[model samples]
Target: MKSKAAIMKTSGKIELGRRRAVWELPAELANLHHKVSIGSSCFLKLAPRPSKHWDARRAAELAVGAGFTLDKPCFFRSQIAFLSVTKIESLPDSVGPKMQTLMVGLNPSPYSSASRVPYGRPGNRFWPAAHRAGLISKDRDIHHALVHHGIGFTDLVRRTTRRAGEIDPPEFRSGFERVKSLIEWLKPKVVCFVGLSGWRIVSNPKAKAGIQPASIGLTTVYVMPHPSGLNAHASLKDLIGH
Candidate 1:
């Protein structure tokens, strides 16, 4: 008896000898070219002659040489099925309408991301400086910052990184666009970017620590020093002064 694979090849069900091979539908052999399923895989329950009705014997025979079983009371189609999918969550921005000031960060740090809070990293001086400057209450709560002082927080990039150096130019571009959109939407009175580099990414590279000439709709922009423990350009006092 011929091998089932050989029989399939010899029967001209699928081209096998040429450089490029294709399946030959039964409709094509039967001159039923008008059928849209001619070039595509059609659902055939069973039997070599698709016009013939499906039965147990044909399914068993087809299953003998084929990799898959065409079960009884089931349809067969030539398509792979995806079994599972996953979605990723991004960090949330702390912001609201008509805020007095919005503090923008370069990106979330690993510590802040883990705690689901901005500038929550233990060694970071952002919270302390903000408190000292009367921009935040003694409490570390974001709600207190927003409700009491009208100070909101956001980031150029939502993704966390160990260091700002790890972020690429593409991330900077995306972050700048997001912040611009936020400014246009929220219309904060004053937008204070907590990092000069991040603000520069959104504006002129020569941007200083003071006010920026560019405005987002009616909002004004300002740049400040990054409060990371590693940033050595200014003392916390000098950062607050800026």
Candidate 2:
């Protein structure tokens, strides 16, 4: 039988509430410790243990390979999402400050951590369109643009799970306060919310469904579809038009 401490060393490092831990696995399936964990941003889950076959090393490798820290384990039982306890990091201070376009997203995803880049997911199209739309200039280096192009990225919610919809209204409302504080302090020209959810949550408390671009305080807010491949029906042109 594998000891829990042994499993800890083999699991991928993950941040969890002021500390970190290795992802847990069933003691019964300890032989084949080399398999990948699976799931999306809202509800990542492990694959079924294959007939007494799974080992910590395999789990760690899979978690690392799949762009996740083992400590941030995601599990699903009866189709309900279960995320292991973990600490959510504060958004970078650099994400604030004067900008022409502030691109607000729902939250970070697992892949974002792996790449160490925001909006880095292959399926997410926010980067390409934002670049094409003149919001992000080709002439400017990434660091410069982040500081000067008046471009910054933030989220309506800061927590990252397998999916964005997992966030509730209160979470959205709380996120709005943080975003509002950023805007008040940063003083950007235009805040381009990446999706309708952001626009609603950040712009108007009464907003339930969706609404068009509206100004809030000194900032102008614009809404666009989320850039996930799920929005394939929508075109990059549509976002640029906003």
Best model per TM-score: 1
TM-scores vs. true structure, each candidate: 0.62, 0.56
- lDDT by residue (24-107, candidate 1, tens digit) is 221121121112231233233222333222233323222211212222333333321111111112234555554899888887
Q: What's the residue-level lDDT of 102 in candidate 1?
A: 84
| Model 1 / residue 136 / CA error / Å | 1.0
Residue-pair clashes, model 2: 15
lDDT of 2 by residue, 108-165 (tens): 6767644445667786777677678776765323345675576766666654666777
Q: Which candidate number has the best lDDT?
A: 1
**Residue-level lDDT for 113 in candidate 1:** 52
What are the runs in model 1 whose C-alpha is more than 4 Å off? Answer: 1-90
lDDT of each: 0.56, 0.50
